[model samples]
Target: MRIGRTLPPAAAPLSVQEVLSGVAALFAGKRAVERFEAELRQHYAVPHAFLLSSGQAALAVILTALKRDRPGRDEVLIPAYTCYSVPAAVVRAGLRVRPCDIDPRTLDFDWERLEEALQGGRVLCAVATHLFGVPADVGRLKAAAARYGVAVVEDAAQAMGGEVNGSKVGTLGDVALFSLGRGKGLCTVSGGIILAGSGPVGSAIENIVATLPREGWGDALKALCYALALVVLVRPSLFWLPRALPFLGLGETVFNPGFALKRLGAFQAGLARGWREKLLRLREARLRHATFLERAGVAAAVPLHGAVPDLVRFPVLVGDPAQRARLIEMSAEQGLGVAAVYPEAVTRIPELQGALAGGAAPQAEQVARRIVSLPVHPLVTQRDLERIAALFRAEQGEQKGR
Candidate 1:
C-alpha cells in the first residue's frame, strides 16, 4: 500500500530579535558567533562554549585535545550504530575507533561490553553517544570511566536538552558537544558547540574555534536554505520542495562549507544570523509531538521530556530487521521521510572491515538490525506523529493477521 505525503512543521522560524541578529552579521569580526556561544554557556551552566564550523569539526577539535594526552595512542571506542561524522571525527583527529556493541534495549553500550573493550587496553578515550535523546546510562558509564581513568567524551549532538535526573546531558561528560544544524533541537544553520570539561580542555576548544577560518558565502546560503525550509515546513501541502525533484527536496544535499570562503552576499548573510529563542520555541513544539508518540506507542519510544533533542529522531527497536525495513518503506509510502539512523553496523563498514579485533559486533549487529529512527525534529506535528503510530500499528496488524 502506498502511504500519503505529509509536510512537517517549519525547521526555521523568525522573530524580531532573530531578524536583528541576522542584520548584525553585516559587519566583520562581529561577536555574533561569540554571543551564540555565550548563550550555550548560560543555558547549560557550563563555563565554556566553543562554537565551531560544524559538529564534526567540534568533535575533531575535542578529540585532538584528548589525543594530545596520549601521543601515538589513538584508539577510541564508538558505538557501532552512530552517525558517519562520529567515526569520521576520530579518523580526522588521527585516531582509530574501536567499534563496540550497544544494548538494543538502551541504545548504549552495556557497560560490561564497554569494560571488555577497555580490557584490550587500547582505549585512550571513549565517545559516549546519547542517541535520539535517550540518555546513555551516563551515571554508570561515568563510574566505569572513573574506574578505568579513561576520558569520556560526550557526543550530545543529538541530545541538546535531553537530561537524566534533572541534569542536562552535556553537563554529565568530561567534554560535551552539540550540533546546531537544521532539524536539531535548535537550528543554528551549521554551527557546533563544545562544552568545556576542565580548564585546560576548555581552553583547547577555544583555541581551535578561533583558529578555524570563517565561511562567508557558504554560511549565508546555508542560513537562507534553512530559513526557506522552515517557512515551508509549517504548510504540509504547500511544501515547495516535494515537487522539486526525485528525492532532491526529499533530503538535504548541499551542506558543503570549507574553512575559508569569500564573504557571503550581505543579503544572504543577514538572513542567517541570530533568532535563537524563536528556534527554541519550535524545538519545544517538536518535543511535545515526540512525547505524545512515546506515551501512546505502537512501538516503545523514549520520552525526551522538556529537554531539546538536537536531532529529534526517536530511536525505535523494531521486532526485527525485516519488520524495520518494512516499516521504513511504509512510512515513506505515507510520504514521511524516515531515517535508517544507522543501517549498517560499525563492523560492517569498509573502514573497519578487517581492522577489528573481534569477528563481529554482535550487540552492534543486533541493534543495527532492530533499531529505526523516527522524525522528532521541530517540524514534526501531533497529527504527523499520530499518523506515524497508526502506520506502525497497521504493520503489526498485518503481521498478526498473516
Candidate 2:
C-alpha cells in the first residue's frame, strides 16, 4: 500500500491530446518508439538514446556490446544487493555475472572490493546500480573504472529519476538504461530505454528488438488490463475490486512482463488525450506527493534528471535483519507488501561463485540483510506514510528492547 496521495491511473484528456499527434500504435509503430527515444535523449542530454522493449533488454544489449568490446573476456561486476534481473541481464548478454559487495551506508558498490574484483577478474565492464533511487558515488567508481579501463553499464532500472550530485544518472556511464515497464515510475505499460553513447549502440539494440517476439491476443488483453490498473493503482481505494473477485480467478490487476500494446490505427485519439491532458497532471500529483514525503523527513530527495520519477521507491535502512523480517511479517498482516529486491548476497549467487567464493563482504552483507524498500511514489497516502513511519519507529524500539 502507498504512503501518500497517488496519481490518477492515466493522464487527463487534454494532456494526452497534446502529445498524441504522432502517437504510434503500441508495438508496430517504430515512429513512436523513435519519438520516445528522442524524448529520452533530450531528457537525459545524451548523445544517443535507444528505447528497448525492456530494461533488462537494455542491460543485456549493453552487456552484449561490452562483450563485443572484449571477446572471451566475459565478466561484469554487479553489486550483490540488486535485482536478480541485474545478473540475469549479464547472463542474457552471454557474459559471466561476477557479483561484488556494496557499501551499506551508500547503497552502492564497495569501491575497494570492486577494485579487487576488477583487477583480479580483469573484467572490462561493470554494472552500477543506484539501489533505491540513490545514485552510487560515481566519482569514486568512475575514477577507479577509468584507471582499470573498465566500461560501466549502469543498471538504472530502479534508478529512473535518480542522480549523482547534479549529474543525471543515465549519462554517467557508457550506456544508461531505464525501465518504463510495469512497476516503474513511468508506467509505459511495457518498454525500456537504453541511452546510447553512439549510433552503433542504438542500432545494435534495434537489431535485437527485431528478433524479439510481438504481442498476441493474450498479451493485448493483458495490456488493456494494465492500462486499467494504472488508473486503479493510482487510486487503489477507488478501483480495488472486492477481495472476493480472487475466487473467480479474475485477478483485479494484470502485470504481464511480455505484453506490448502495439501502435494501432485506433487508440490514436486516446493517446493524444492521454499524452497532453493526462500525463502532465499525473506527473504533477506524483511530484507533489514526493515533495510531501521529503518535507515529512521520510527520505532524502535527489535532483532527478531523465524521466523524473513520478513516484520512487525508497530503500530505507533498518540495520537488523531479524527486525526487518519481523516488520515484513507484521506489514504483510496489515496488507502492506514488501520486497528485498535482489542478490541473496553477491557472496552467495552461483555466478559470482568464483570471485571470493569463500569471502565475506561486510558492507554488502549488512546491506543485504538490513535494507527494506518502502513505497515513495504517488500511490502512497498520508495515512500510509504515518503508519509506515510509526511502524519503523516501533520496530526499532522492539529491536532495541531485544
Candidate 3:
C-alpha cells in the first residue's frame, strides 16, 4: 500500500475562495445561474446556452430534444472506445447506441467505418468527442453527417479550452456540451453546459431545459461538502488518505444511466466565478507536462492532428499489455499517477450488450487493451514527470531482459 505522497490520477482542484463564493451564491437566488449561463454563451459565442446538473444530463437533454425532430430515428452513433458516460447518456435518452470504430492513433472515428455507419438512415446524431482534450476532426465528421441529414453533437466535455485551426471546439458542431465535473478543464463541483445554434433544434433544447427542475438545496450542500474535501485532499501530499479508501471509488470507471437531470444550482454556478482565467492556466500547465512527456520518448504519444489540445491526461500507446500493466503497478507503488483509461471498448461493456446497434470494432478493442494515460493536470510537478519517465525507462529495460 502506498503510504507516502500519493498523486491522484487526474485533478483540477477547487480553491477555498471558490468554495466560499459558492456558499455566498446559495443566498443569491437565480441570479447566479443566469450570470453563469450568460458567461458560457459569451465564451462559446452560441445563440443559446444552458447549464445542467451534469455532463451526462446535458447530453441526455440534447439527445431527447434532437429526437423530437426525428422521431423515427432512434439511434445515436458514438466512439466504441470512449467514456462509458457517452453510451449511458444515450441509453438514458431512450435511444439505441450505434458505436463506430475509432482510429487508434488519433482516438477519433475511423472515417471509412463512420461513412459506412451513416449509410443507414436510422441515426439521429453522431457524437464527435474530443477525448482527453485532444480535438477530434469535427469538421470532417460534420460533413459526412450532413450527407445523411444526421446532426452532429460535439462532445467537448473534456476539451473546453481546446482549439482547432483557431476555431473553438464548442462552436464546431450543431450542438455541444462541456463537463464541469472534477478533473475536467474547469470544475464547479459538478455541472455541464450546453451550446446550440438558434434553430428548431436549439428551440427544442430550450423547451426541455425550461421544464427540468432546479437542483435542490440539499444536493447543493452535499456538493459543497465534496468541494471542500477536494480542496484539502486533491494534493499529492494528502491524496493518499482518500486513495486508500476503496468505498470512495476514486478512480473507478462506472456506467450508471440513472444520474439526475436538473438545472445547475446557484452554489455550483458561483464556484465558476473566475473560470475564464483559471481554465487558461490549467490548459497551459497540461500542455507543458504533455510536451515534456512527448520529448522523453518513453511511449508512442497519441496523435493530436494539427489542433492545439488542453489535455487533461496525456495518453500513450503501449505495445505490450503485460508491460503496460507493470508500468501502472510501478507508478501506483511510487505515486506516479499512471492510469489505464477504460477497461474495455463500449461494445464489450456488459450493460450495453443488447443496446448497441453496430457490429464489432476491432481497432477500438485494440486501443482499449493498449492505451495508458499519464497525469497532466496543473498539480503535476517537474519532479513528478521525472519520476514517471524513470518508471517507464525501468519497465522498458525489464521487458527487454525478459
Candidate 4:
C-alpha cells in the first residue's frame, strides 16, 4: 500500500462485494434502474422519482418542464453564490438567470432580495439549494415563491440525506434533485435523481421522463469507467495527481454550458442501490465530525435553521482571504481534504458575465473569498479529525501572530 496520509473529500468506498453486485446489475438491465429509482422514492418518502445523467441534467429537465408549463415566464431566480452548473443548466433549458444575493450568515438566498426578485412577474421558478448540505430555509423559500406564483426547485445535489424539521430536504419544494456523482453524499459515479411530489407538475415531469431517451451503450461504458476511476483516484494521496495536471483542472471552477443530456446508465443505477444502506451511516459520520469542530470552536458556528443537516462538507469561514488560503494549504500538506468551495460568486465568473441579471452580490463575494470546506465523509477517522483540529489551531495561531 502507498505510504501517505488518507484524508479524502468524499469516497465511494466500494467493497469487493459491492463491485460484484454492480457487475450483476449490468446483466439485470432495466430492472437495475427501476430498483434504484424505487429505493430513492422509498428513502425520501416521495411519490415519484426519476434517474438522469447528472445533477445538472436533472436541473435542466426541471427548468424545461416548468418553462413548458408556463411559457410566458422566462426567468429563473437562483442564489448568486451557487455552483456554476446552476446557471449553465438554466441556460441549457432556454431560460435567463436572475441572480439573487445570499445572506452571509446562512449562505442562502437573502430573503429580501429573493422576495424582490420573485415579486417581478417574469420569474417562472426559484431555486433553493441546500448549500454544502446545510439546509436552506425551504419553508420560507416556498412561501415566498408561492406568493408570486413561481415554482420552487430544491437543489439537494450536495445534500441528499439532510432533513428540515423532520421533513427530508428533497421533499420541501415542488421538485428536487439529488446528485449521485463521485464525492457527493452518495456516489453512483455520474448520475442524479429527481423527486417530485404527486401533483400536476410531478405528473408532467414523469411524462417528460418517460419520453426521454434511454442511456446508450457508450454512455454506460463511460459511466462504468468513471465508477472504476473514482474507486482508484478519490483518495487524498491520489487526488494530487489530477490537481497538478493543468489540463485536468481538478479544483478550478469553470463555466461551461455545453454537456450531454442522457439517462442514467444501468451500471451506475445498479451500483447506486447497493450503497443505499450506507447513506445514513455516512450522514451520521459527517454530522459528528462537523459537531466536533463546531464545539471545539475552531470556526464560526454554522447556523442550522432548526434542521438536522446531513452535511456533505463542513464549511469554515476565515475572516481573512489569505488566511483561508493558508488553511487550505496547511490541510493539503497533511493530506487532509480541505479546499475553497467556489473560486468566486457565480455572477463574478467571466464566462457567465453576459447571462447575469445584474445585482450586487457582496455577501456571495465574501463567502467565495473566505469560505473553505473540510471533508467529513465516512473515510475520515477519529484520529484524522484530531490531527485536522490540531493543524487548524496551529494555523490559526500562526496567522494571529503574523
Candidate 5:
C-alpha cells in the first residue's frame, strides 16, 4: 500500500466548521431541517422540497407516490447502466425495474430503446439520470413520458449543482432527487433532497414524508461521528489508511435494497450550513480538473451538450477491460484515484435477475466493462492530473507496442 498521499476516487470533504455546525444542530431541533428545505426550494424554484435519510429513500418515496397516482402502471424505466442504488430503490418501492439500453458515448438512454420502452404501456415512471454529472436530455424524455401519462424522476444524485440551458438540473423532471451523501457535490455526510411541484403528486409525497420517522439522537450522534471522521480522513494524505482496510469497503459498489427510510437528520442538515457557497466552489474546482483531463485526451469522455456538469468524477472509456484493470491497479499503487464506477450493468446484477424486465443491453454491458472515472473533486491537485495523464499515455504506448 502507498504510504504517501492516496487520493480517494471521489470526495467532497467536510470542513471543521461543518462538523461543529452539525454538533450544534443536534440541539437546534426541526428548525435546521426546515431551514435547509426552504433553501432547497428557493434555489431550485420548486414549491415542494423534502429531505430524506438517503437518496434511495427519497426515490422510493417518490416512486410510491407516483405509483399511487397510477396504480395500474407498476414498472419504472431506468438506464441499464446506472447506479445500482436506482434499481434497488425501484424494488424497494415495490415497483418492477425495466432497464432501457444506454448510449455508451453519452451514458444516457439509447433513444430508440427508451421510446420502445415508453410505448410498452406498463411504465409508471422513468428515471432520467445525470450520470457522473453529465446531463441526460430530460426535455426529450419528459416529452416521451408525457405521451403515456408517465412521470419522470430526475436522478440528480450525482449532479446536485449541474446546469442545462442555464437551468438547474434538479428542476428538469416531474420530481427530482439529489443526494447529499459523501463524495457527492455537496456533502452532508449523508442525506437526500427531493423537489416536486405543488400538485397531487407533491401532496402524496408530503404525506409519505410526514409518515416517516425522523433520525433520533442515536442516529444523529452516528452521523456526527462519520462527518468528523470524513473531515480528517478524506484527504489524500490520510485516505490510504482507510482504503487499506478491507472492512471499510472504501469504493465498493453495493446493491443491497435494505436501507433506512427516515427524514434527514437535523445534524446532517446542519452539516450543510453553507451549502450554496460550498457547492459552487466544489463545482468550479471539479470543472477545472475535468477540463484538464478532457484536454489531455487520455481517453474518450462521456459527451456533453448544452450542459455544464458539476462533475464529481470525470469519466472516460477504456475499450479493453484488461487495460482498464491495469490502469486502475496502477492508479492505486501511485495514489492517483482512478476508479471503475460499477462492475456491471443493472441487467446483469445477480440479485435483480428475476426482478428486472428488459431485453439485452449490449451497449450498457460494454460501458460497464470499459468505463473508469478519474478524480475531479476539489482535493485533486494539478500534479495529480498530470500524473494521471502520464499513466494513461504510458498505457496507450504499451497497447500500441502489443
Candidate 6:
C-alpha cells in the first residue's frame, strides 16, 4: 500500500565494503588519487587524466586552460538548457557565456542556431552535453565546431560510461569532464576527472593542475559529510526528508557560482577507485529502464539519435506545465522519486540573465517547463518500474478522458 519508498534521483549505492574502504583510505592518502587517475585513463583510453575536486572544478580547469591559450577568443558557447554550473564555470574561467538554444527533441544543441552562434565569431569553445544519459551527436557537434575553429568540450559529467558508435562519450570531444558526485555514475562522495586530447589543451591542463593547490582539510571534511549523507539518505524512503526541507533546497535549481576550485582528496579517490566497474553495471540497468519507458510511450528527455547513453537519470517531457506538475507531485506522493531535472533554462535563471547570447530560447524554455526525470538508478526495482509505468499510463488515460 505504501508506494512512496524513497528512490534516489541518482546514486552510488553504499555497502559495508565501501564504508570500510573509505575508512582505510583516510590513511592511504594521495596514492588513491593517483590510482584512480590511472584506472580512469585506461578505461577511457585517454592519454591524460587528472582527478579533481568536483565536476565543476574539472570544467573550470579546462576552460581556464583553454582561455589562457586564446586570450582574444573570450566566449564559450553552451547549450541554453543545461546545468547552471556550465555557465558558472565559463564565468569562473573569466570568459563570456554565449547560450545556444537546444532542440526539444534531442536536448542537444539546435544545430542551425549553434552554427549561427559559431559563425558569429569570438567563440573559443563549445560544450556538448550528453544530458540525462542520452548521448548527443558529439561527432556532428565537433564537425560543426571545427568549421568555426572552436574547440569542443564534452560534458560527460552525467554520462560517464556512455558510448556513441563504439567510442566513449568522454573521448569524443577535444576535452571531456566527468563528475563523481553524490548522484553521478561514480561517486567518491564528490570528485571529478578531466580527460583531454594529448595536444596543446592536454599540456595546458597538466600545467594548470600541477600549479593547483591540493585539497585542504576542509574539502576532506566535506567529502566525509557527502559520504555519510549518501549512506543515510540515498534510499527512496529517506530522500523525502531532504526534499521536505525548504532551506536545504534539495531539488531547487540556482545559478550561484561560488564553488571552491580544489584538487581531489585522497579519501574521495580511494572511495571511487573500486566503483568504476559497478558504474558500468549500473549503466546497463539504466539502459534497460530507458528502453522500456520509450517503448511504453514515455518520451525521452533527449532523443537517442543512435547514440548509447549511460544515463544518470531517465528524463521525459510530460507535456504542458500543469500536467508535468501533476505527474511530479503524484509520483512523489507515491514515493516514486519522480522530479524536475532543472527548474528553468540557463537564460531564464535570474542570476545568469547577463550571460545569454541576446535571443529568445523558445525550445529551452518549453523543455524546461515540461521536463521531469525519473529514477533509473541501480536501486530501482522491477516493481518500481511497473509502478512508474502504471502512473504514466494512468496519466495518459486521464488526458484522453479530458
| lDDT of each residue in 297-325, candidate 5, tens digit only | 65546654323367888888985899899
- Count clashes in each candidate, considering only residues at least 3 apart in sequence or on different chains: 7, 33, 0, 0, 0, 6
Estimate, for each residue in 1-402, the C-alpha lDDT of model 6 and write its tens digit.
233467767776776567667667768787877888888788888899998878989999999999887778888998999988888888888878888899988898998898898976689999998887678788898898898889999999888877787888799999999988777877777778899878988999999999888887777777777677778777776777776767977776767678878888787776775676777787889878767766766666666543436678888887699999899878877888788888888778887777656577889999999988988888888888888888988998999899
Instruction: Give the per-residue lDDT of model 1 (tens digit) for 334-381.
Output: 756555565577777776543444446787777767777776655566
Question: Would you estimate the TM-scores of all the predictions?
Answer: 0.83, 0.75, 0.98, 0.94, 0.98, 0.95
Off by over 4 Å in 6: 1-4, 303-308
Runs in model 4 deviating more than 4 A are: 1-3, 304-308
| lDDT (Cα, tens digit) per residue for candidate 4, span 1-402 | 223654666564655455556667888888999998888788888899899989998998889888878889989899999988889999889888898999888888888878788876899999999888888888898888888899999999999877777887788888999888777888877888899988777888887788888787887777667666667666655666655567866667767789667778688777766465678778788888877766665564266433336778888788688888887777767777777877888778887777777677888888889998887887787777888788788877887798
In candidate 2, what are the lDDT values of residues 1-402, reduced to their tens digit?
Answer: 433333222222122323234233544444554565566677777767665556776677777766665665667777876766666666566566676777665667777787788775458687777665566665667788877778777777755654455777777876777776545545555556677766665566556556666434465455555555544543545423422235733212222223332322222222322332344454565566555545555443234433334444655666677777887767644544343444366566654454332256667767667766565554556776677667666776776897
lDDT of each: 0.65, 0.57, 0.90, 0.80, 0.90, 0.82
Residue 111 lDDT (model 2): 70
Q: What is the total number of backbone clashes in candidate 3?
A: 0
**Candidate 3 residue spans exceeding 4 A from truth:** 304-308
The full ranking of all candidates by TM-score, starting with the best, is 5, 3, 6, 4, 1, 2
The CA lDDT at 218 in model 1 is: 58
RMSD of each: 4.2, 6.1, 1.3, 2.3, 1.2, 2.0
Q: What is the lDDT of residue 74 in candidate 2?
A: 68
Angstrom error of the Cα, residue 337, model 5: value is 0.4
Whichever of 1 and 3 has more TM-score, that candidate is 3
